[model samples]
Target: MVIETLPARLDPEEAKRVRQERLERIGSWLLPLLIMLFAIWLWDRICVWNEIPRYILPRPHVVAQTLYTDAALLFGSLLVTLKITFLSLLLAVIGGVGLAVLFTQSKWVEMSFFPFAIVLQVTPIVAIFPLINIYVDNQTAKLLLCSWIVAFFPILSNTTLGLNSVDRNLRDLFRLNGATRWQKLRHLRLPAAMPYFLGGLKIAGGLSLIGAVVAEFVAGSSGQSSGLASRIIEAGYRLNAPRLFAALILISLTGILIFLVLSLVSHLLLRRWHESALKQER
Candidate 1:
């Protein structure tokens, strides 16, 4: 006997609806971008009228000139800052995820270590920077530690919440399937936790950048292996307001880029099957 298989069918009207929706979304973004550009222009005009001194608040054009003239230096230092942020984030994810798993596995461990994680989160990194620098002996390592401390708590707390927030029914189902604790964790909890994990990652990305900048400020590491934070400090000290603003702009742009990249990654990972990511799109 021969068997026949049919191709899936799609409604033309549904396809057209989706296309229109996408176009509407694009238009929404375009309008906001245009508005932002107009606002920048208006701000520039006001600054020009006020005759703001370059030493105080430089003209946007002057800041742009400084940025373009020192593009190479700025870009190179940006890479250093990016590297430290990325590395610290990687370490934070590993440490946080591992600890979260441990906490979920043992109530005693959760009770013991969770408070310390809270402490780490609440304690100002500025206050600890001196201690960390003294103990680490390496300036670079000290900066990384400071960044890691800033980034780690979110991942730990969020992941722990995600891991434990699994539905009781699901847990029972897994147990009914003769699933071991490890199997349940691998198959059920981890997938359930991805949304929370990504949320924490987004927050952690920004925090990592802040931590790196703050640590550099505290450590006064502005010579070799220094990042954009040091450049901003140097510019400020030299009374070059335009250069300082340019550096600040670069840092802000870098942060936005990091956030956008991570958001894209999260969308790619979760858009297919996850309700939280795909609900609006659907």
Candidate 2:
């Protein structure tokens, strides 16, 4: 006699695992949010209990109010800062990938120019901004150049490493198949290099924002054309701590948004095929 198989239903172990993973993900976000709320409560309590002046350490509400009251000014400044950040990131991607391609084609080119890239990266933007300010007549150009300098090297290095990281066996197979150099690059090398390029892009995004802010700080460009860094400096001079905190919050949020967007991009592109995006269950 043969036994009949049971009807399909949820596996107890699999369901338990899924629920545990969901809780962990939710807790990951919730825990930090709860901590932040507690910190804010602590800050508000300290200010109220000690009668701390608004100029010294305004309550959280004051910072929120400042953000709302100066929304036009702060947002406008943020737009300028964002403009610089995005443009620099774009230029870095172009220049970095272009040079990395050249490097892949010729070892001599990599050896010749890679050191210069490293120099630009290692030299603090604060130091370079003075020279850039003097040499670059256009203020916007100076800011863009300063930002691009910091963002450039990561993309260049990562892409170069990716391009060269192709498996030897894959290259040999392509060669055996009579694949041309361009074909090998398009079909074999580029895909292998994508994760590295995306990784570089994510790093470059944050660096570009930092470079823009640092350049603005050093340049001390103010008035209508000023970026968030200028607002921060102006707030410091006026002893407007709430406004300073608000500006800082904007900058931090901008950075976090950039990173999240880049991370989403990486996940979307890689989820179908890459090991980095794959979910491994124990």
True-structure RMSD, every candidate: 4.9, 4.1
The residue pairs in collision within model 1 are none
How high is the CA lDDT of each candidate model?
0.88, 0.92
Q: Pick the lDDT winner.
A: 2
What is the C-alpha lDDT profile of model 2 across 11-99, one tens digit per residue? Answer: 99867876898999999999999999999999999999999999999999999999999999999999999999999999999999999
Model 1, 1-282: lDDT tens per residue? 222543365489777886898999899999999998898798788788998778997877888999999899888889988888999999999999999999999999999989999998999999987788668877678889999999999999999999999999999999899998899889999999998999899999999999888888887753565688888888888998887888899999989998999999999999888776765533
Against the correct fold, how does model 2 do in TM-score?
0.93
Model 1 stretches astray by more than 4 angstroms: 1-27, 221-225
Model 2 lDDT, residue 110, Cα: 89
lDDT of 2 at 226: 87
Predicted structure 1: lDDT:
0.88
Worst 10 residues of 2 by lDDT: 1-10
